[model samples]
Target: MQKATGQDGGEAAVVGTDGTGPADASGLTGDGTGPLAGIVVADLSRVLAGPYCTMLLADLGATVIKVESPGGDDTRTWRPPVHGDMSTYFMSANRNKHSIALDMKDPEQLELVHRIVGEADVLVENFKPGGLAKYGLDADSVAERWPHLVHASITGFGTAAGAHLPGYDMLVQGVSGFMSLTGETDGPPQKGGVAMMDVMTGLHCAVAILAALREREGSGRGQHVELNLFMTALSGLVNQTSAYVAGGAVPRRMGNDHPSLFPYGPFACRDTDLIISVGNDRQFARLAEVLGMPELAQDEKFATMSARNENRDELRALMVGRLGERDAQQWQDELVEVGVPCAPILGVDEGIAYAEKLGLDPVADAGGVPTVRHPVDYSRTPARHVKAPPHLDEDREAVLAWLEGRGADCEG
Candidate 1:
């Protein structure tokens, strides 16, 4: 049923010929297996982190009402990567939800947001600290009015301290010590290619919201859950941060190398790169044999983990010499068959294609567009998608109709 879309270039929503929802929408599920079908979410957040969180909730089966301004979310203007003039950046995270554009400065529009919030089981926002005060939509005010609503506040920092700082991902990465430990040791600190901080923060926010939802069921009350970009970045550093805090070992940039794990990085083969992960001494021994240097396994300077750490350069030089005789894929096939952990370096598109070949089905067809499928696999209740991301204010009439209608479910 996927056909040519309208001028908006969003994924086509092919309902019945009459243009209503599908004939058999017993609930909100496309495949009739959504566990969170009854829950309504008023998504007042914009841009990556917030939208990503709401999109995940929508995939879990919440009816998400995305509130955008007159111009829509900022990512809508991020261009160059376009799908028929649509902002692929915006599409990346805003799927499986309905979008409504409103100007908060307009009293009437502000009332519409309030109406949506009144019915929402969860409210997510990433407004600057106190940015929504003019409209009385800030966390404290909204929480006071709707005591049962789970209010999630995503901020650059806490409300009281560092409130003036902007919550850009790169800045958070730099300040959180992520940049300091990335890239080559001799090179200047570099930010990651993707906005990992934003992604991590969004995931953390989603988990906290889900937890609050569980608590609400027991206590019949909702609490304010707050997460910030910098804090998430700090926690995301994981073992690197632990080394500094617990072991007093300030980690430095080693490029693709792990500070303590030798032979656990990418190396050049005859034609391309293949990454090998030698986690333990056993794996190291197998690697030694694969390189046709079984005698190296008994060399006192390269036998054990500590020894490998001490002679990492010598070990790498020897392996590189051996790998130079075979192409990356050939070596990968041979090493993997023997239980060695390794893979040939692939581009993003190749990775997707490989996932498809492996039957992972990493992409979900929403309406007519393909989106990254939800990472979690629920055997009993699977994630479902009804439509694609909406164009700016494209569903305003339908949303307004639903809002004005006396439907407690907020199917608007």
Candidate 2:
């Protein structure tokens, strides 16, 4: 494990007091390994949003104990593409956490869970509105007992007027107008291929938890944070949302093209499709030169961003004609060399390879399966080696032992 150093050469380290007390949980015990050295997380969320949030925390050196309700997270069985009998979707998110399959229905097991929560610094759950309250683990209930615990809740529509409504990424994409802004003008609305809304909401949850932890440093108290897919989707709509709110225009799907910018989309080359991002007039001018249509830059219909946007269809056809003369890679190289933002749309495998080649290390070997890597990088206290997502109930004994020791010391 490399020491994650900050820009100022300070080693980045976790600051929380692990339930096992200060000395034992601070850093690795003479073995020289560990990422999250002192933080404990009881992860109660399942599927994409909640799991992703905890995974991020785990990647950053938190000791995350994932609590599964017997059947195992539904994602564990969600597979057309399975490795080691594990769903790729589940593998993608639940890394660096010790899994504990407990039947919360059993009163004794439920009591154990309460004890675990009492010893944890953070608790993350994505149950539907009031779903966890019956089990005595909702934010208010848990925070009442564990005042220092940072409790995070993930919901689909949020805990407001829409709390009872179940939120799904595709549904939110549809209801929040994301789908309406995708696809071609005459085509059906298309949701994103990936569950991006869930992913984003997960990211938001992680961010909010970290902020709450920082606040706890001064206040010595924890906070309950709530994140929802609908709100997250709406916030992510960005330009589309702004257009509807301010301009009173319902945006339509424009397929592979920018709504406000010309030539800021994909064009078909001879062998493949290439995405070009001609952001401003200068880029457009450069694009014209690159395409052997330098004269087009001076044409009034395609001179400025506004003018080019107005005549985007015409400009797109012209660019496509010129672009079709060469292969995508060749065109991409030429455009990129001239400062035009462009790329040949690569598949997932190719994207992974590209990131690896650039030393980005997008995924890491967790336990045995490859897990997506955390995006943030620190200099002094660098992230540790990837740990595979745990098998169900894998670390219950060890986690319980650590907690019991801590509880005993607190009593002493």
Candidate 3:
């Protein structure tokens, strides 16, 4: 395994391994073997969306220098759930990167920031439409100064009519009609438990940045990439949005039930609820066999997928009656054995444990902090968990040294 020097000149982490090894001094990993090993990102955004996008790039082996204000990212104080002195929430989206604090109001510090952006391959910011214009760090300003830079901007809404509105995931959920479709049929509109809009927007921003970087290779110039939470929320709604636009049908909440497919939601068993997803007529037939009602697959009422959907009320009654004969775990085992898609409801811990049982290895250690692993795996160049999230201005000295051409690696 390859090793990197930590701030204290001790071994920080083992890089180029499977990421399940001893902790490093720098809390960093990776051996410059990732696909994006040589790339540099100037992360000017704070909070979830911008940080999340930059973290993805960092995992893929980019040298991400997180530029925060003197107060640091707002999430540093979003605590009650913390690790040591850092917020776990903040840590969730910030890893494998170095952090430095700089106040743009200070002319010297702003100059330093400009130098960083000038050297970086990409710049990511989530400031409101014109929030960065005063600092001369906005898209147009950056394009004029650094034509080879990929400038990616994220907002709550587009720059035109909705620029004044603050961007928040829950607010976008309400405005984009996601909340309206999230709850039970009779219940009040509800937001998702997580900030899904922010996450989706981050993913969209990352893709756009990658595309612009690819284009720059061909044209020797970069372009501005823009994304907004409201638009991302609409695109993420997928089928529901299509239902309204393409079919002229407004969708409504249906509890855990799917709008188009029957036998695709949770059903009560003897001891607990189990989700049985039947995607096609053949899967429905296999499910019928598992329930000891093979004849139901041939019945006119439930024979075809459309017929089963149309008569879901009656078919659900029958299936529920049959499922009630066995415990959810028992049914899960039998259904899975026959290739019918089914699983008992699991808590978050149980879900992680299940993934572990299946050899997915969903957790990784950054320095000493535990984190969810990056979701993608590459054959030639896998994602790396280089460093733990930084403390407020923790890497100031090394970053400054690098800025001064000293070539020093940041301390943990």
TM-score of every candidate: 0.90, 0.90, 0.91
The sequence of per-residue lDDT tens digits that candidate 2 reaches over residues 1-412 is 2222211123323233332333234321112234455666888899899999888877777777788988889898888798776778888888777777788898878876776676677889999999999998887787776777788999999888999888778989989989988888899999898999999999999889989988987886788998899999999988888888999988888888778887887789999899998889999899899899999999999999999989877888898888999999999898889999998788899999999998998977766677667677787665554567777777666656555554422111
> By TM-score, who's the top model here?
3
Residue-by-residue lDDT tens digits, candidate 3, 249-328: 99999989898999899999999899999999899999999899999999999999889889999999999999999899
Q: Write down the RMSD of candidate 1 (Cα, Å).
A: 7.0
lDDT of 1 by residue, 216-296 (tens): 877766778999998898899999999999999988989999888889989999998999998988888888888888898
Q: What is the lDDT of residue 78 in candidate 2?
A: 85
Error of 2 at 219 (Å): 0.6
lDDT score of residue 283 within candidate 3? 91
lDDT value for candidate 3? 0.83
lDDT (0 to 1) per candidate: 0.80, 0.78, 0.83
C-alpha lDDT of candidate 2 relative to the true structure: 0.78
